[model samples]
Target: EGDFVIMGTDGLFDNLGEDAIAARILQAYNMMRIDGKVARAVCSWASQALLNDAFNTSLSKTAITPFSIAASEELDLAYSGGKMDDISVLVGMVEHQVQA
Candidate 1:
């Protein structure tokens, strides 16, 4: 019975305002509903949107910055250095039931 789903980046939860995230979610929901796509597809789209937004607004251009290919290394270093901020998520929904 569900119409839409959401997949989001950690940045949206950590840095962006809730109102903004809500608005985006609503927008994505409407889009998915209109297109008749499944919740998992919608979620994938939404997650990419969140990451794209973050990449666009990031201030650091260093090749080894946290948002770059070095993200994994940076995360490891942060863990060792006692920086405990970690965020990763995935969301999906089933739009129809399958018959056995």
Candidate 2:
């Protein structure tokens, strides 16, 4: 399978960590496999999963998110959960061209 890339704004990171992001992408990939969707479709499904997770996490008051942990560790702040923000997610894979 070809490799895929995931890109997002700070808002995305503010709620989800690398582990969470990877999990969502993996879920989407597996789902595509079951649905008969090509690998390229994985990116589209993954992006939606990521966006939904981040947006939901941002609204939580008790969730320990990446940003909250960073704030506590780096700034000694008492942040406990993700802040509501404008989340953006992009997922894609490079396609190879074959010459006849």
Task: Give Cα-based local distance difference scores for all models.
Answer: 0.51, 0.86
Backbone clash total for model 2 is 0
Residue by residue across 12-74, what tens digits does model 1's lDDT show?
354334555556667678878799866667777776665554444343343232333344565
Q: Which stretches of candidate 1 lie over 4 Å from their true place?
A: 1-10, 60-89, 94-100
Which ten residues in a row are the worst by lDDT in model 1? 78-87
Which candidate leads the pack in lDDT? 2
User: What is candidate 2's lDDT per residue for 33-96, written digit by digit as tens?
Assistant: 6887876678888888899999999999989998899889999878897879899999987668
Candidate 2 segments whose C-alpha is farther than 4 A from its true place: none
- Please state the error at residue 58 of candidate 1 in Å: 3.5
